[model samples]
Target: MATNVLICDDSSFARKQMARAIPKEWEVDIHFAGDGVEGVQAIREGKGEVVFLDLTMPNLDGYGVLETIRKEDLPAMVIVVSGDIQPDAQDRVKKLGAMAFIKKPIDAEKAREVLTEYGILTGA
Candidate 1:
């Protein structure tokens, strides 16, 4: 099955970088959202099964999106991708229901590991 994925970040560069980092073997229907509001909306619309979410963004932030997802019981696994490597930030996201927290300059290998660990990816 092709997984629906969302990349939510204010920086176009980050979004593109994340898109590139995704393994081609995942068979994802990729979508982009510039902020948390759009990310939440995309989740509501069932456009995302897995989300790569940025912490700091204009209009809405990643935390807000996670909160919305939890409140609404949205069916998307959020993986936080942030420049802030603070342990506090990581804990907060996890408490808010993020499946994983990855620091800035996402590593493709780590990304795959997270997905695989979460049972979102298997095999190749």
Candidate 2:
């Protein structure tokens, strides 16, 4: 089966960028969510096995979503994709059970790195 990925970001541009960056060979099933609330709902609805989450959102920010996921025992690996490069922010998200932290302006190389790190993309 193909790996599934959920992208949650408020910016349409970001979403488009991410869509393009992910390698086609991976055959990933991508799903988009405009905010954390929707992202959480999508996860609950069995959208994906991994989530690309944005930290700064209007409603139910990434932290809150992570907390909810942890509290509810949701089975998904969350990779925080955000522009917030602050050390504290990254640390907090890491503590919240995020599988990885990926900086924004995502590129194909970074996407591949993340997937490989999580064992989602194989064949080194």
Candidate 3:
């Protein structure tokens, strides 16, 4: 079965970059959310299996979105993709139940690595 993915970022450029980074062979069904509010709404609407979330966003940041997901018991694997690589930030996100914490400026290699590590992608 194809894995469903949601890419949530305020920046259109970042979203596009992430979309392009996903391997074509993965057979993923992709979705998008412009901000944390939209991301939460998308999750409520049952958008995808996994969410690639951005930390810095207007109107409800990624941390808020993660909190909402936990509180609502949303069933989606959330992987934080942010420029913030601070230890405290990583700890906070991990404590909130994120499956993975990936640094931003997301390249194709790093994307694939995270996906594979999370079992979202199998094989080459």
Candidate topping lDDT: 1
Model 1 segments more than 4 A misplaced = none
Candidate 1, residues 1-124: lDDT per residue as tens digits? 7889999999999999999999988898999999988888999999888999999998889999999999889999999999999989999999999999999899999998899998889877
Report RMSD for candidate 2.
Answer: 1.1
- lDDT (Cα, tens digit) per residue for candidate 2, span 33-122: 999899999999878588889999988899999999999999889999899999999999999999899898887899888888778888
Encode model 3's per-residue lDDT on 7-124: one tens digit a residue: 9999999999989988889887899999999999988887858899999999999999999999989988999999999999999999998989889898888888888887778876
Ranking by lDDT: 1, 3, 2
Clashing pairs in 3: none
Per-residue error for 26 in candidate 1, Å, reads 1.1
Q: Rank by TM-score, highest first.
A: 1, 2, 3
TM-score of 1: 0.97
Model 1 residue 82 CA deviation (Å) reads 0.5
Range of the 10 consecutive residues with the lowest summed lDDT in candidate 1: 115-124
| Alpha-carbon lDDT of model 1 | 0.92
Question: How does residue 115 of candidate 2 score in lDDT?
Answer: 87
Model 3 collision count: 0
